[model samples]
Target: MILPCTSAAQDGWLRLRQALWPDCPEAEHLAEMAGFLREPDKYAQFVAYDEDGQAAGFAEAALRTDYVNGTETSPVAFLEGIYVAPQQRRQGWGRALVDAVTAWARTRGCRELASDALLDNVASHLMHRALGFEETERVVFFRKELS
Candidate 1:
């Protein structure tokens, strides 16, 4: 079953978030999730639970007013991240989480939903395609520092 992440489920969500982004500091994860807990309308996270009431996956999404790739509408629903346990993948949990986010976005009057994955993550690319996202463009970013 998919349900909105509650304040009481912060630790569960943290575990899933760390699994998806191991490089991110635990403190950073807590700070970010704290923002979600404070603002339910603009930010949202959903957790998928198994029959035994254990978290199996999660999706974090938000409303983005900035320019979003492949989107022609403003204030799009942007999927910040999603992860399903290796054992839970291919079982429709991921899709259900996305569906929940989509429903939430619709309630917020967003006309489109957008997401992105790293250039080298082929599995993520394929997953996005399976989730009905079409490729709009690919970009390789560069930066220069000046003092």
Candidate 2:
């Protein structure tokens, strides 16, 4: 797998998104992917390719200057999402995806890296732990229906 992204990979990136959100309608999925592609730096996303140049995974990295949950520093690179194909799991492909995005973060002078998954996502929790992220704090959203 390679460590950088290019314009040529946009189509492959969209494919990866579709794989990750299989339930999303094609029109919505394509629109979401296109929004990222419209960015000036494409700093919001990156693609992981397999040996045959197929998109095996995707890592969406973005820099946020304000309110990163675990750190006080500004301009932290937040990993918005990462997904490796089911067949590609457990083969170090996911870690490679993270590594690729981390390297990209360092270039942008990011002082810290941050990512979050749903509280009950066991696999995500394990992956984050394996990657050396600590349990900083747990946040639970509360909701009440308005009648």
Candidate 3:
């Protein structure tokens, strides 16, 4: 089953988020989750549960008015992150989460959905393709610091 994340206290969502982004502190995760909840129209999140009612995965998406590479539409639904428990992968949990996010985006009048993965994460690339996303572009961001 797929469930929308209606509360920041939703442990399943937080747990999956931490699993996907292990480097982020719990406090930071909570803070960001709260922020997303406060903006329901701009952000959407979903959690997937197995038949046994255990959390299996989670996905977060945002409506971005700013330009998203490879997308031609404004206010595109951009998938921020998605994670399925290692033991739960290949079981359609990730697809369920993305489907939920896509439905939410449609309600918000978005015409397209966009997502990105690290260049080195080949698994993610394959998963995106399996989920019906086509490659748009490859970019390497550059930055410089000046005092």
lDDT scores in order: 0.89, 0.77, 0.92
**Candidate with best lDDT:** 3
lDDT of 1 at 92: 89
Comparing candidate 2 with candidate 3, which one achieves the higher TM-score?
3
Badly placed stretches (over 4 Å) of model 1 are none
Model 2, range 4-63, lDDT digits (tens) per residue? Answer: 544534646767777777899988866766666676353567777788877778888888
**Against the true structure, candidate 1 has what lDDT?**
0.89
Over the stretch 1-147, how does candidate 3's per-residue lDDT look in tens digits? 998999987758888899999999999999999999999999999888888899999999999999999999998999999999999999888888889998999999999999999999998999899999999999999999998
TM-score of each: 0.93, 0.83, 0.97
Error of 1 at 34 (Å): 0.5
Candidate 1 Cα deviation (angstroms), residue 59: 0.4
In TM-score terms, candidate 2 sits at 0.83
> Which of candidates 1 and 2 is the stronger one according to TM-score?
1
- Candidate 3 global CA lDDT score: 0.92
